[model samples]
Target chain A: MSSREIDRIDGSALPLRGDNIDTDRIIPARFLKAITFEGLGDHVFEDDRAAMADHPFSNPAYRQARIILTNANFVSGSSREHAPQALNRWGIHACVGESFSEIFRGNSLAIGLPCVTMSAADMGPLMDLVERAPDTSLTLSLSDRTVTVDGQRISIAVDAAVRDAFLAGTWDATGLLLDDFEVVRGVASRVPYIRGF
Target chain B: MGKTLLKKVWDLHTVRPLSTGQTQLFIGLHLIHEVTTPQAFDMLRARGIGVAFPERTFGTTDHIIPTLDQTRPFQDTLAEAMLSALERNCAEYNIPLWNLDSENQGIVHVIGPELGLTQPGMTIACGDSHTSTHGALGAVAFGIGTSQVRDVLASQSLAFEPLKVRRIAVNGTLGNGVFAKDVILEIIHRLGVQGGVGHAYEYGGTAVDAMSIEERLTMCNMSIAGGARVGYVNPDQTTFDYLRGRRFAPQGDAFDRAVSWWRSIASDADADYDDVVEIAAAEIEPRVTWGINPGQSVGVSERIPATGDAGTNGAVAEALDFMGLVGGAPIMGTRIDVAFVGSCTNSRLSDLREAARIAKGRRVASHVKALVVPGSRAVLAAAEREGLDQVFREAGFEWRGAGCSRCLAMNPDRLEGNQLCASSSNRNFKGRQGSPTGRTLLMSPAMVAAAALAGEVVDVRDAL
Candidate 1:
């Protein structure tokens, strides 16, 4: 475990159009049986890509897209860490949506796949821009809390502490917990239920 | 204004406020199962970190364990590997594992409460989404991802942003055949899956107060379905009574002290809530999901909603297409190929009893493969003691051992291609029960039994 930072992402976009695109759709339940998250990227949107030939992830223009643009409530089911791992492995650096599920956002941030949100009023146009021009590159600034696409700057909303962690390269929570080992042991010792083997 | 049970428990467990505006909260109980913990354990080994509190954690093999056979060296190599991994990890980490042979072994959510480990005012964490099921004991239990599983294993703490409390008050009398499953399905129907995303739903009111501990557990178990991170009912005499005489619960005067503390942690009558939504119990029906998501549900007698009538026209179209159903047609009498009466959601003794009552003297349709998996080994023992297993067996339903069989399907029990199932489990997402194209319809255990008997989705009220 080591400290990691995600300050900005400048890449093409893959626009997934829908509200409540669940984790099941991101990475289906069948793929969750693996011992580790390795090799999950190739199967991201496994069902949708196979079911629908024109799914955005499979669209040739967005082949190397590093950002996922979508509507409200993206990644909204089951707390499968594979959802983010799939995206990270598939080369997704950031996600811009109207909102994200709590567990999904946490999972994304933990793996350094920043999930940022823009107001709904601003999201529609931004999504249209990305979809209308797949070649359009977008830049997301964690410190500035904004996304710049085609010279247009759109304000994004992110939890301040979350953004701070991303900007300062201090978001590796596991590493932080490991660093505060003595304090963690102190807290564990205080818990009535905690006991050593 | 008074504090909510969520706040009371949360504040009590806060180790310190982190620079990230997240509270480093101590977790009292950590639950693990075969599927999710293997990677977390691997992470621990790779990092050379020991579990901070082994006793605070408990392990069980549910997801990958075979419910039909008890022999070692499972037929599925992957399943065997998962079980072996869990066994090795638990042994090396010094955590007590409730293996298949253990009396305490069952679904992670089910065993915790039965063993009296799920007490009031405690913060519980598990890798499975149904961890919210433990919230029925008045604890703030929510699911975490595998990475957080590693974090908790190493530190026994989580960096969490506190949630605003949302009071969902269901007042008035519930009509006949309307179980706790209906109440939660109705709530999800009204709120949509994303409605409770950033909040902790504190269920209260006359309807919830009248429920048994099992019923309350059923309600809180689906909190994840409503997109709430955590859901709980306040501790009352009902909760205390359930805990008394249990394995891990306090005994004698210590029990009395524990009860007092638990009572003190209940949300005050005037507790401040960020939002309050009221549901009239009389309005709720024996609900069943007709679409892929939990929110896309209708009353037992209601028609499959038209695309426009379903509110989200595009989503309804997609769901209807995926489910192979027509909009504006009656959902009742829709043919089902399978019926599953188990999951962390509704597989307790009471659930089995209800299903058995419906299954008595009736046989499962020849085309419908039905199964009844108990939530815990204790539940299985209790059901066997009452001859419920025999009743199910006689009715042509395969009575399986205790495990999460056919619910998310990590074991041999899974749906064949395009098989439609009536499931008592929480999620109805496409392929949630194993087969990529398999369809699942969410309903009560009794409803699932009814479907098995009738060969199609039918109203349990009429069957009764």
Candidate 2:
């Protein structure tokens, strides 16, 4: 494992207080027909934002923000990989929520993005800060497994394996499978081979 | 101490439990589709591996196949490549493939049971998650990843941990207009999306046992979103009868032996369970999704729940904001602009008949665009036989060919930006119908017909 702490993404956090913002809402299912994940950032919430012009993320000031903090159930719906790929194309580096759908977590992890789950209380102040000050640089540290919005430390529990995978930048699912195979083989080697001559 | 469907299937398939905390389980049938197989085949080619048991596996195209027009050299280059790749892989492996022109062509989940390929006592695997839909026939069907797909193709076995099984028993009788779609929507709503997270649900009791094979398939299909590995109903006369004459199923004496084994694999009447859930059949109504997820649901008679009324479940608040729905408005009067009736969830001939029965002699509301998609060619032929297509066409519903149209919007069937849809398909996650801002309200096939006629959310009972 790598010893260095992976650098956290810096951004003016875009806080969406919505519930059940699903994979399609994150990126519409129409975009999934495309061959690759390139250029999907252009269509992010294309219809939702088209109706609601004043939404925070639609504003030009939030263009460079790489971190997004939303309420729980941020990613729910069909297990479409295009959802997170759209977010990544939109330049999203990390997402923090109270909870996530199991399929969403698996897809996000496969592509090297971290979905951080924080306490609802921890998210409230940060949401307020983002809405109150658009220019505020909120630092989200996945390595520390905490959310610091406008310099306020918010404790959020994270799975050690998820943290280590992101921190070491060793988020290779295929590599993980290889390691698993070796370990399984090692255990088998120590056991009796009933039929193999 | 529990004997769930998972245990029953597991014991029947196990050769031995390996030292690596996984069981060496035999797979009796393997189903594949175009979308997830191209990459898996490439991986196999790189390693010089071939499918171990060619006769036990089958392939078809669904995900990227067009329902509207499937001309040569598709407008979608990637889709064309995917189809080409899958065709090549199937040919290279000498596996029987039912391509687009075949009379049997349709969604993998739909075709498996139609041809009697899915049967009781069979351990089935597909690369797509909705593979569980075939479990309606009492088979143990689960989705696996691409690597696992390669694993199955190479070895005809999968190594995996055992899953707990939950027995969802529904008793009593269902009210008219409350179809199978309502039964599944109610199950997901009452259980919440995560309720079945680590379990395979074995649906039984008077309700499941009483249902037609098609209705049972709809119930098993949605178990994926409920977080279950798979779901099934036990095999019986209905199952054996369905498989008895299919092209792929065993014939005559062999079939007799197969039926005997299939019957024995069913959970014993005295079988214990990890958990038992009781749902009254009369308690369910024509349901719909009020917010972004299937969990964010309400009956057609109820209104959307407010985030403030969510009472500290953080997910509810998030769902509400994403949905932009006001909690207090009655769902009954909510206007709908589109109505889609297709997908592996509710696209069978029986589903169309239920919808058409309600839609008979009634036109869709002027502003509402209604569509009726058959699950497969066989369903289309069967519907045509019963004049169900005429009923749909007279009702102002677009009668389309077979495919997984608008379920995930990989094809042309999609909701224009923010168009709310009364859908009979399985899911209702935000933007699931092709429009990122589109809202989906899931319900029974009958309810979708009623909603389409009224051009808004309406009680199916009123239409009935």
**For this target, which candidate reaches the highest TM-score against the unseen true structure?**
1
lDDT tens digits by residue: candidate 2, A1-197: 22234547677777777665665566665555543456878888776687688875698877877888888666655555566767878878888887776556656765677888888876787778777887788677876667676567777766566576667664533333333343433433332111111
Model 2: chain A TM-score against the true structure = 0.84
- Put down candidate 2 lDDT per residue, B1-464, tens digits, no spaces: 43555677787666555443446666778898776566668767777767767877899877777777889788878778778887888899999898888989888888999998887767898877777788888888877655567667776666655677799999988888777777877888788776775578889889888898999999999887676658899988888887888877777787887777677778887788888999999988778888666666787778777656745366666566756666778888888899988889888888898899899998999999999888988998999999999999998999887888888777778778778888888777766777766778888888888899999888989776
Per-residue alpha-carbon lDDT of model 1 for A25-141, expressed as tens digits? Answer: 788766777788889999999888888999998899998899998888888878889899999999999999999989999888877888999888898887788778999988999
Weakest 10 consecutive residues of candidate 1 chain A by summed lDDT: A188-197
Q: Best lDDT goes to which candidate?
A: 1
lDDT of 2: 0.76
Stretch of 10 with least lDDT, candidate 2 chain A: A188-197
TM-score of 2: 0.81
The CAPRI-style docking tier of model 2 reads: incorrect
Q: Give candidate 1's error at residue B117 in angstroms.
A: 0.8
Model 2 chain B, poorest ten-residue lDDT window? Answer: B15-24
